[model samples]
Target chain A: EPEVTQTPSHQVTQMGQEVILRCVPISNHLYFYWYRQILGQKVEFLVSFYNNEISEKSEIFDDQFSVERPDGSNFTLKIRSTKLEDSAMYFCASSIMMGDPYFGPGTRLTVT
Target chain B: SQQGEEDPQALSIQEGENATMNCSYKTSINNLQWYRQNSGRGLVHLILIRSNEREKHSGRLRVTLDTSKKSSSLLITASRAADTASYFCATDNGSGYSTLTFGKGTMLLVSP
Candidate 1:
């Protein structure tokens, strides 16, 4: 079965540096989303995009965070200036419709 | 928070035993899905139970939903050592589009 895939399985960056996490969603999927999981916390929704614009977002998705589908299959999440608290497992998910979403192997981001 | 809450944060069982996890959510949901994550790995799509469906089965896994109770349960029968992982229940708050809230997952250890 086709699955979502992400690059740079693990990322380590200095505090205040910019970091971009990349994902390639399933080819036919239309809705894209980003979620994060702190080491021992629940998964938190960051943002969702469809029709080339953001459909919904959570408070956790603040000014420093942005998402872009630069091309057909690539969805990227960019953090303008990373903070130490930004370390977490970031997941990318996609779905053809509004129901179940297929998730990708997450990218673990660590800012020191 | 629209996120679900799972009980028994951790569980341990013999390889041949059955493992059960329960999830409870606060608001209305369009669908509920269960995913598994191995240590430091990806989220694996397990099973999805829709608002209209009461129970679903796939191989050794079974899931049941109670909309009125706003609760769901996942059962893994005849589990193996490979089943050791964290099981998460994710809910899509509504049907219009895709934004999910996930619970803090239950960690299961299947010992051989």
Candidate 2:
């Protein structure tokens, strides 16, 4: 089965540095999403994208965060400046119908 | 309050036994989905139960949704040690292409 793929499985960055997490969703999928899970906590929604624009976003998705579909296959999430609290497992997901999302293996972001 | 709060945060069962996990949501949802995650891994989609559907089954996993009560349950019958993982319930409040709210998840350990 086709699955979402993310690059840089693990990233370590300084608190003031920027980090960009990349994902390639299933080729035919139309809806894409980003979510994060802090250690031992619930997975929190960050943002959703469809029709080349953000459909929805959570309060946690502040100015520091931005998502781009720079190409037909790549969906990237960039953090302007990392924060210690921003360290978490970030998962990228996509779906043809949006109701059933297939997730990628996730990128573990560690900011010191 | 949490949107999708699952009960009995942890469970342990012997091989061949059955395990049940319950999830309750605070608001109306378009659909509810179940996902499984092994330690330090990404989520694996298990099943989805729509708001209009009461029950759904896939393989050994059975999911039931009660929109009136705003509750859902996941049953894993004839469990195996490999079934050990964290199970989470996520709810999409919109009918399509929307953000999902997830719960803390239930950690289940099946010993052989």
DockQ of each: 0.84, 0.84
Model 1 lDDT per residue over B1-112, tens place: 5468898899999999999999999998889999999988888989999999999999999999999999999999999999999999999888466688889999999999
What lDDT score belongs to each candidate, Candidate 1 first? Answer: 0.93, 0.95
Model 2 chain A weakest lDDT span, ten residues long: A94-103
Off by over 4 Å in 2: none
Q: In candidate 2, what are the lDDT values of residues B1-112, reduced to their tens digit?
A: 8899998899999999999999999999999999999998999999999899999999999999999999999999999999999999999998457678999999999999
RMSD values for the candidates in order, in angstroms, are 1.1, 0.9
Question: Using alpha carbons, what is the TM-score of model 2?
Answer: 0.98
lDDT of 2 by residue, A51-112 (tens): 99999888999999999999899999999999999999999999997689999999999999
Please give, as one word, the docking class of candidate 2.
Answer: high
iRMSD (1 decimal) for each model: 0.9, 1.1
